[model samples]
Target: MSDNTKAYLHIYCAKNIIVDEQKFSELEHIKGDDLEDVIKVSTDKHIVTANYDLPSNSVFNSRIKAKDISISCPLLEAGKHYVISIYEVTPEVAATEESTFMDYVHAEEIEKGYSICLYRKK
Candidate 1:
């Protein structure tokens, strides 16, 4: 069995590119008009399992500790751009690109594992 740990996964949708701290801080308090800027889609606890042998073609395969980190979030939808933050405190806006969702994968044997995928918006 793969070793797994409980972690908080914060999902954010970027409306526009965050260049400065002021614009980045807006992600914290989402207002009416600001809603179009950045939206905190989902925040939840999940079991993150390490995949030692990840597919070579996978985009996240090169990322440290990202290759096999699997979690289930039904709220995720296909074809939508998202930023997946895996940290206790507020995640820095800079990790947005590196932490982007790859895409969804079906895991039938892994308990509680759902379609896992991550992708960036063009």
Candidate 2:
């Protein structure tokens, strides 16, 4: 992977995440005792294919019409938000057929029934 190559980090487990500063600022005004706290997970180190669109009832989705939602994955929970990050991975990592995150996850799954990944982007 060249320095120009980039990778996308998708946190599948997070129920709520603020990807941008603008959106994160809004959390302060939300009134509720059960406000979700943002947990900064460390990056163990982390596709643009089809132009698929999300269903009309997709979560954290803008009411727009376009074919850019092709990368949608099944949300583990409804009405929850997950963070999507994009960054460059090391050349060694990017060269792998599997993502660095997946590589770590798969190894953990074999060693332990459950695994925890805390990856913070640099």
Candidate 3:
């Protein structure tokens, strides 16, 4: 498959969570069409941003390891928590295009010491 066809996976965590191979492997099975739909709907309704969306025509999939959420997101921090989400986006949508403070327009508490916040960065 072409690069576009290959899924882009990202990892983010909330405050010093030990992430190891086992954690990553545990998350490997979490990606699929069903999870993608949940992410799409949740992001579309909650996140308020014009540039925030998953790449359309490209597979939108993700998984979580430890307290980190892994998806095709940019500007992810290793010790910060984020809610896994998806949104239809153009294939050419550069990750940098949405990397701005204003683009981070939402935040919500998900788990103790873990909160979901909009992020756009490398």
Candidate 4:
């Protein structure tokens, strides 16, 4: 009944900041409690920041379509733990945020040369 691919959904768990991306798929069915907090949108802007647990705070840029986000920063180096967040920021959220490098390969656009979803590891 929808043409869009659901990428992100879970505001309650994300609110207390307990939801972990590594277990993102587990949150898919998370519901019945404070789930209404989830941000519903035709479009939204978000950022993916990766922390390699190093003194240097270097991050790579990536984007997500709609209000849903799914990305794992692959900057893991030896002897380091990586942490990333998909922050739903305000005051700076712009229409251009949806226009990103990853948008081209969004799940819905897969047949149109955005076939990168297969390597996304779900």
lDDT string, candidate 3, 36-113, tens digits: 211112111222221122222324645333333322234333333233333233223323235533244334443443
Candidate 4 per-residue lDDT over residues 23-84, each given as its tens digit: 32433333434442222112233332122111222255343222333332222222221122
For model 1, give the 10-residue run with minimal summed lDDT: 1-10
Q: Model 2: runs farther than 4 Å from truth?
A: 1-4, 19-101, 105-115, 118-122
Give candidate 2's whole-model lDDT: 0.28
| Model 4 lDDT, full chain set | 0.27
TM-score of 2: 0.20
Which stretches of candidate 4 lie above 4 Å from their native place?
1-67, 87-122
lDDT of 2 by residue, 27-109 (tens): 33222233423422222221111222223444786684323211222212222223332223332343343543333211111
TM-score of 4: 0.19
Using TM-score as the measure, the top candidate is 3
CA-lDDT, candidates in order: 0.32, 0.28, 0.30, 0.27
Ranking by lDDT: 1, 3, 2, 4
Q: Which candidate is the best by lDDT?
A: 1
Candidate 3, poorest ten consecutive residues by summed lDDT: 37-46
Residue-pair clashes, model 4:
0
TM-score of model number 1:
0.19
Task: Pull out the clashing pairs in model 1.
Answer: 51-68, 101-118, 101-119, 102-118, 102-119, 103-117, 103-118, 104-116, 104-117, 105-116
